[model samples]
Each structure stands twice: as C-alpha cells, then as structure tokens.
Target chain A: MHGLRRVPENLSGRGDKVMEDKYDVVVVGAGPAGSTAAYSAAKNGARVLMVDRRRELGVPVQCGEAIAEDILNELGIKPDRRWAVNRTNAVKIVSPSGIEIRISEKKVTGKVGYVLNRKVFDKFLAVRAVKAGAEAMIGSYVNGLVFKNGRIGGIRGVGLDGKFEVAADVVIAADGVGSRVARWAGLNTALRFDDIETCAQFQMVGVDFESLSMLEFYLGSRISPGGYAWVFPKGDDLANVGLGVLGSRAERRPIEYLRDFVSRMPGLSKGKIVEVNVGGVPVCGPIEETVGDSLMVVGDAARQVNPLTGGGIDSAMRAGTIAGEVAAKAVEEGDTSKERLKEYERRWKEAMGKRLTRYLKAKEILLGLSDGELDKLAEVLRGVKFDRISLTDMLKVLVKANPKLLWKLRGLL
Target chain B: MEVDSSLCLRCGACVSICPVDAIEATDSYVRPNERCTDCGACRKICPVGAIK
Candidate 1:
C-alpha cells in the first residue's frame, strides 16, 4: 500500500530503467540480513532495492558457517543440498586439561545444525529477494547517506556502471561488523577494544575429525586467551578451523595463535590450508539505538551477535525480518518518523534482547575465570551425564562442586 | 598510525574500532586518514598484526 515518490528528473541524468532513482526501501548489503529484509518488505507490498559492494555474493566467506536448524524453520526456509553442505548433531567442548564434554540431544539440549557453503548460500538468498520483486545492484559501494530536511532520505554510492543516488522512504543498514552506514546517520555504533573479538580462520582439506558429525571447541588461556578455538566440519576430511581472541586480552595477533594451535595439534597439523579469513566480531550485545527517522540498522551493524557463542546468522535473519516488516508498515502509514520506527526496536527486544544481555553477562564471568578454575570446573563434571540440563541446572551443578564459583555466578542464578 | 600493507587483510577490523573514523578500507587497500589520533585500537584488533 506504500507509494514510491519520484525524485526530480535532474537528480539522475542517466535514467537507467533497471536501476531506479527512487524506491520505497533501499537495503545496503546483500547478505542474509539485507536480502531477508528486502524479501520481507517486497512481500509486504513495498518496492525495494538491495545493494552490495561485492561483485559476487558470499565470496571470501567471513563466517564459521554453522547455523541452528531451528532458525531456518522459523524463517520458513527448508535446507537445500546446494548450500547445506553438512549436518552436525553434537558439540565437543575441550578444557585446558584435556577434559572433554560431549553435549548432544541425549546429554543436553542440542539440536541438528548445518554447515553452509556461504558462497552459494548468500547468492541464493539474494536470488529469492529478486524473485520477490526487489531489485538488486551488486558491485556497489555506499559511502554516504542522503539527507532531506535533517532526516535520512536515501543513499549515495557507486555501482558497476557509475556513481548513482537512490531516494527511498527507509534505509536498512545490514553492512556487517565494520558498518559505517548507521554511524554516518548519527548513531554511535562504534565499539570499544574490550567489546570486540578479533578472529582468524582457515579452511583446510585432508583434516581429521573425532566425529564426522560433531563440532569441536577448544577453550583455555594458552589456546585462545579469553576466547576459544573451533572446528566445524564441512566434509569427512575437510573443516573450517578458526579462533577468536578477546581484543582486551590478545597478546598477539589472532592468526598467530591459530597457527600455533594448528601446529601443536596432531589432528590439525596434517591438514593443508586452502583459504584464510580474518575479521572482527562485536561482542557488545545490541546497540542502544538502532532506529532513527527513515533509518533502521540490523544484523552485525547493530551488534546483534551473541556475546558468548559468537554466532550471528540466526539473530541477523530474525532481526532483518522484523526491521523489514516494520519499515513496510511505517511506509504504508506515511509516517517514517523515529517515533514510528521505534516499533522495530521494541519487537526485536521482545524476541531476543534479554537473552543477548544474559549471554553478555555470562561471557564476562567466564572470561574472568583463570585456566586453573576452568580445569577444576571441567574435572568436576568429568563423567556426569544429564538426560537434559538447563543452563541454570548446569550452573548449579558447577557451583555445588566448586563453591569458589558461587560469588561470580550467583548473578546468573 | 600505519598499516602494513603486506600483512593487512583488508578485512576492515581496524575500521570499525577506530573511534575517530580514521581508517578507510577498499577491496585493494586500507589506510589511516588524517583524523587518526594514534589510539592503537586498530593495532590491537588487527588479526594479522597489520596495523601499527
């Protein structure tokens, strides 16, 4: 029910038919969040345009690529063989003293998850958005925002053809961790050193796995230093090996730690590295303000990543859906003010805000524990198996065995 | 602040943590702009020791 407002004819000289100068909504970044937002907006009867700086979608994959099946189900999407490369059913957690805790559906609350081929998966989502009547412009870089009467009006950027400006009623920023879009619009999305996780990853072939369907996590100060290392399997002999180091505690670059870890591990040292990815993850939880007049920020741009797990694909998609729906409704009602856009913040908070805050608190406490404490905690639960244990129950068990942890963990209880 | 181009990955890790918006990155290169106050936030967060 929203109508597209046309810009002055002189604003754009080219008048390209495929690339319009105006749209109901313009989404920057064609990843899961942007594509999902475009798709939802278009489905809700809004004319949409999605853009990405990359010439190809998902190239140079930046993620570990593991996502829970429940997320896909909630989005009403079925896993396809083309992008879902492998399925994992369990997680192996390794402590500093070589203690292993295997958690699966039988032992704890775990579910089937997928390891994605992001290069294919990102393009697939973009294609779905296009099919839903959203126009996509790849190989484009958005460097600035267009403001009209002191409010966000549109985006200004360069595409494969040339420089262009597109006017829109609302702009969705899904530009990932280093996003400057929202900041450019006057939102303080800057992160502190202690609030981020510096990370590095290597996709290797001929790797060894303890279990083909299990994900491995190595935790210890010597291993990662206030963070952890992970191995997510892609095939029987292929895996994505990675590590994240807390920015405040990192003594060396994350890549150096990862290389040392791989060299020391017999199972990983034998593999050959095929690809390298280095990036940063914001572990600060969601920003305070994610909505402004005619602007909405979602995904990593809004710091929607899980502080404890460093997982974001699920939250990004969920937040994108809500942002898109809210943007469409605001446009339809002809009120794209900050007051109207506040609905998006309210809805996402109602869904996952409290959980993210709790995780942030847990991450702080866990990161404060020394290697000796972690070892003691792991030793206490060495052989204990639970049919099903809630996070509180697990915390209670640890607190009972090691009363030393009671003061630090009492907040969680 | 200086970016060791050889070690830099153009991943924009430094760009986000720069409080003054002093870093700029493209597909081919990353550089510190005039706004840089030598805070070292970028250097600390660089995954490959690219920033100095």
Candidate 2:
C-alpha cells in the first residue's frame, strides 16, 4: 500500500496513465539478498521498496536449499521449524571410484547445517522485511531502469495493475543470476561460458540415504564435467537430487546429465520427481565491481556465489546486510554516489573476498584433475579424522598424500 | 533465435548470459528479441536444450 499508488493520466506525457511511487531505496528481486537488504535498510530508517517478478516470494524454488547455521546466527535470525526441514552436521564427499570422505562439524565453520524449505524460508524473510518497514510488490517485472545524467535514479517495471515507476535514492540489484538490472545500470555483467555452471535439480520423494542429516557431493568428470552433483536430504525418504555442469564443458543439456545421474544412482533412481528446478550459477566469484553511482548489486547479480560449492545463500545474505546498511547511511548523508557506496563493497570484500578467490583457484585445480586423481585424493582422505582443516591444511594433506600434486598445487600453499 | 517451448523451463539462464541483452523472460515464457546475434550463447547455456 505504500508503493505504486494510482496517479493522474499522462502526467509525464505518456499516453497511458502510470502509477508512481518514491522511496529512499528500491530493491529489485525479493530473494534472500533483496529481502535482507530491505530489512537492513528499513531497520536503518530508510524508506524501502522491494519487488519480485514472482507473484509469491519463493515459488518454483531454484536453489539447492542448503544453508549454514552460522549465516543465520550472523544475521540474527532464529531458525524456525517450519523452514528448517532437516538439520545436517556432516558432508559426505564421494569420489569417482566410490570412495567417501565425511566432513564433520569440526571441519565446517558452522556447527550445524540445514536443508531449508526455501519456499517458506524466502517468504518468511520477505515478511520480516515488510514488518521492518519496507514495502513489497509481488508479481512485478522490472523491464528498465531510470537514469539521470548517466547515473541510475529509479526503476521502470510492470506490476499486476499496470505500468509503474519507483524513484529512489539508491537501487539495490539483488535480481539473481539472470539479472539485467546491473547491465541496465551500465555495468558489463555478462558472464563467460567458462564462468557459469548450468544446473538441473529435482525435489524427489522416496529417496534413500545412509544419513538423513548428511549432505552428499559427487565429484568426477563423467558425473558432472567440471562441476559436481549433490544430494541434500530434506527428509528421511526425500531429497533434492541435482547436478551442475560447466557450460564450456557440457556436451549435452544439464537436464540430460541430471537424468543420467539420477538413473544410475541406486538410492535416487527409485525416487519420484516432485519438482524440477534449473538455472545458471555464476561461479566466477565476485565480479570486478558491485557498486556504481546510486546503484549496488548483491546476490547472484553481483556473482557472489562460492566458486567451489556453488553455494550463495550465505554470501547473498551477508552482502545484502552490508549493502542495506551502506545504502541507508549514504541516503541519510545525501550522497549515494559510487564513492559513498564503496563502503559496502569494501566491507563485503573484507568479509569474504579472499576466500572466494582461493575457492576459484581451487575450482580451477579441481577442473584439471582426472577422475583417477580424484579417486586417489579421496583414497588419501578417506577415514582421516580432521579436528579442523582449513583450505591450506587440506592442500597440505593433498600434497603430502600425492607428491605429484605438489607442483600443481603449490600456488595455493 | 527460436525456443522450443516444450523444453523451455523459463529459468532465465539464457537471459543472464546473453551479452547482447537480447533475451526477455516473462513468467510464462522466455524468448530472444531481434537484438539476438545468433552467437549460440543462449543455446549453450540452456539447461534443457530449448534454444535453437
């Protein structure tokens, strides 16, 4: 009710009457990033409007639905039973030769892991944003951006009623991997084939798992070709079976790879597919720039996904909080220029930039490994009890196990 | 560019990777506009092999 109110006909010389609204901040896309940004901005006293193309906040789910509990704690969110379907504390990594390496909580930064019901979790986050004084518009598609003297000023989009415009001091682009908002704002956000991982997933019922509270990852070229397959259990007999293949390495569609993967896995082949989700993940790490004059990009729009795991919810939420806080402060100071907004970029980089870069390098190394080498690596890691292993420690173990890998992995050391 | 609607998932992967901003995605469908350069970027990124 606070946004997109009716306006007089042809107020700006357009033939059709357009509804208009104004806010201190306008967030495109109401996913984790957008909702979190809205919540943060509003909490910091900024008049904010959050919009999403979906009529519902989290319908036709696109994520693997796994999140670390540390992120929730960091965001000060209490885990609700309605959204936290299953709690996992271990991750099982399976090699091509069927060797399994289990990583316990000690190895993970978070004490607990959760496979979320994103439909509920995402909506809950949006509702929280609204409750914190942000306005939300659903079923709205942002088609264009309003620019003033080469600086982003607002957004133009179609809502359920009709064409609408929302002028804002700052616009946060949290529009996911397929985002055009940043590009429209003069940022070259185009992703290369090598930087993207085309993914396919199915929410399945009646699948079998050794541990309902364990997340499974399968690694091998034959399985996913430069990416990996995952099974995140939502319940004892249900799971999200998915796989991602690097676009540059893919010979067939990701769906075909997913089908083949599901068909071959004894535990998954018997399951019934309840939902199909597919999308492209930007595994290129964070882009060169995420902030422009009056514009800030968060979430997948800014390529904030982890290169090695293809996980983004954590990064998105963290960046969203920072962007929201910065946007609000910048607006309060009456300076939403790129220089003022650079604080958001600096803070987020300080938080996760080095880790992302290291992961990207690790991903490149993993892509160069043959299935046999992966098996050997897994063999060396199998049954090893790790109190706490950082990336450097993991690399050291690998180097010790397979001295041949020393030269290839010395860069990481 | 042509989309085989039967296989298209409306996931917008093609829209994100297009350097030309040629793709448009609605809730029900996704299509390539005249700005398309036939670079096959969309086809390569399509998860279901829907683009032609």
Candidate 3:
C-alpha cells in the first residue's frame, strides 16, 4: 500500500481445458532460471509444467552474454560449441587514465571463457528441461496467482489457444526482474531506484580491435560512472558494446551514456549498431527473503543477480536447481506449506547468499571510488597473488597477499 | 504508467518493459516520453506499486 499496487487477482482464466487444470509444480518463466528449475524438478520425478510468454524462446536476447567457465563446469553442464560464439582468455580493465591492466587469468574460472550465443543458450536450457520430462509451453503468459486460504493454490493466465487455469501444489516464480508472479504470491519485490542500475547495450558489427579474445572493461565517472563499460568481443569484427549506470549516479539516460561512450572509442565509433537492448539491474543484491507458503522464488524475481557484475545466469541456474530439488522434495513429502518449503530458502542461502552479500558490499565501495582512486586501485591490483577476484576470500587475506598493491581497503576487510 | 515520485524506487522495471519504449529513467526519476501512447505496459509490469 505504501509504494506498491496489485491487480484484483480474480481475472486470471477459466478452467475449461483438462490439460490446464494442474500439475505438481508450475514454473512461471522459461529463461535460464525457470527452465533450469523445471529441468531439475522434473529430473527428480516431480510432475512439472513450465511456461513462457515468448513464442520463440531465447529470442530478443536480454543479457551481457558472459558466464564464468568455472561455474559451468561446477553445474555439470558441458560447454556446447554451437552456443559458444567466442572464447576470451583474459579480462582487460582500462582505468580512467587509460591505464590498461589484465586481471590475472589464474584468478578467473578458466584460462578461456566463452561469449555465449544467448539465443542458442537460452533455448538449450529450455529444451533440456523438456527432455528431462517437464512439459514446456511458450506463448503462455501468467496473469495472476490463484490464492486460497492465504496460500498459493494455482495460476491463471492466457495463451494463443485460450484462457487457462492450472492448479499446482508448488509454484516456482522464476520470472525475471519485473516478475508479476512474486507480487501475486505476496512477495514485495520492489527495488529502490538507487538500488537499480540502468543498462543499455548494442550488438555492433564491423569493429577493429587489438585483441579479439580480450574481454575489455572501461572504467570512469565520465565513461559509465558507478558501473563499467564493456566490450565483450564476439569476434574481431563484432562485439557486444554496452554500459550499465548506477541509477542514482546517472546524470543522463543510460542510452545517452552509452552513446557518448561509443562515440569516444575509436574502434567502437566506427562500428554500426546491429541491435539495441536496454534493461535495469537490481544491484542491492538478493531480496531479503525468497520463500512463502506453497511457493518459492528464483532468479531475477528474487534478485539473484550479482551486485558487481550484473551476472545471474550461473547463480540463477544454481538457485533454480536448488529450488526445483526442494520443491520436488516437498511434493514427495506431501507438504507444500511454507514450513515445509522453507528449505528452499535455507538451501539457496547456503549455496548463494554469502557471495551475494559480499558483492553487495563491494558494489557500494566500488561506487564511491573516483577516477584517481580507481587508477590507484588498478596499480595496487597489479601485484595481486592470484588471478581471480577471490569473491569468497576473507578481506584480510586479500590485503595481506598484496600489501601495497591496493588502496586503504581496511574498511572492506 | 505514472511514477509516484514519492514512492518510486526508480528501479527501472517500468522503463525497461515499456513495449513501445516510452519511459525514460534518469538518476533522479522516471518519466514517460512523447512516444508513450498511454499503452499502459509499464503500469502492468512495474514491480513496485509506483505505476498507476
């Protein structure tokens, strides 16, 4: 009531078709998280149904298209050659003063990481879910949640065929950032403007670059201010050129920032914009909670995005795997109540909460840095002991390893 | 969708999802552009209760 709104919740659908009546679990989205959740649940023997609003899955790609190689391996997903467009060996960070430093290869998950073909990767995940025995449908949009006795009873929505209503013992709200499912299930998914980072990107063709395999990062208040501009090369002649601006620090629209950034870069300036994509990122880290009666939230709906990198594909898949497993367990136990379902929240936190907490703090500190400070940071990091960001390392261990390489990071410790 | 200046968290959900791309989000606030067409896409998709 203070800063939120809701639809009446009654106008979902008519229960006419038997196929739309129910399932053991219903996943709300078909993106990586949702699809992964459905796959995991179905694999564990849960009767699962996953629906997407898009007719063609993974079209209109809405991502930065980068994932850590280590995470992919950790998740037991074999890298698909067809879905990997480019492989970058290192990350090249350019400071405000034009000082370029390569973040150590050892620090990253792999010596080479792939730039994904999201169109293929997203579809790949959804198809996997279907193959795992989950019923997958596209062109179906979830309109509202059917609540009974203060619990999530079912879902009501529409599709190309007609109106549909499906009851389910468990619901997985794997919908993305603007998820209506979470709200309908009584979760307050409101993010503050300041907590959101405005983002815009262009898939540019005809670009000239020194390193076709280097993942390039440009930093400065003028360049991206509170966020970083990236040139993730798909090839020597093409790249995904984009920037995300911290909502509070952006003086102009995100598009304007990217336009100015593109104009100033020699290679990028000469490139033609093939496609433009814009989005918002909740940088405040994961929401306070992720579970409710007969329901669980995953992926962007739960704000599982990395506060620093704006990367959630790995984390989403990780959470989806956990949520699906837990949901299936609840169904097997014949208890879909919040008490029984609380394990999903517990398991997700155990798997992802710690890292997200660290990134949230890191994002705040990173935002306060000036160009000179960032340059100094670059200088300090040049002496790092390892190649990775050490996201899980204790603050003292990071500083102790390279005493003079960084600035006064005592606060971070 | 109308941003409730006092309530709007400026999360950019409405701005990002506007089908016709009408909303513009700056650091301070979010507003509709000339092309808004009052399609109400933003109102339906805003995560915060800000849009009405």
Best candidate according to TM-score = 2
For A1-413, candidate 1 gives per-residue lDDT tens digits of 22122222111322233676889899998888898998888888888888787776787577889988888999999999899999888788889888988766553455688999999899888777777777777777787899999889999987667788999999999988888889999999888888888899999999898987788999999889879999999998999999999888899988999999999889999999999998888999999899999999999999999998898889889999999899999999999999999999999999899888888898998888888878888787767674442466668889888798888897787
Per-residue lDDT of candidate 3, residues A1-413 (tens digit): 20011111101211133143678899998888999999899888888878776666776576778877776777798898888888777777788988876654663344667899888999889778877777765667677798878779888877656778888999999877767677767777765556677777899999876687688888999988789999998876989998888766777766788889999999989899998766677677998778888889999888999998898888899999999999998999999888888888888899888889878878787787789977876665555554553544434554666686246454455
TM-scores, each model vs. reference: 0.93, 0.94, 0.83
Give the best candidate by lDDT: 2
Better of 2 and 3 by DockQ: 2
Runs with alpha carbons beyond 4 Å of true place in candidate 2: A1-20, A106-110, A388-390
Model 1 lDDT, residue A17, Cα:
38
Off by over 4 Å in 3: A1-18, A106-111, A382-413, B2-12, B15-52
Clash pairs, candidate 1, are: none
The deviation in Å at residue A144 for candidate 2 is 0.8
* Deviation (Å) of A4 in candidate 3: 41
Candidate 1 residue A239 C-alpha distance from true site, Å: 0.6
What is candidate 1's CAPRI-style docking category based on DockQ? medium
Among these predictions, the greatest DockQ belongs to 2
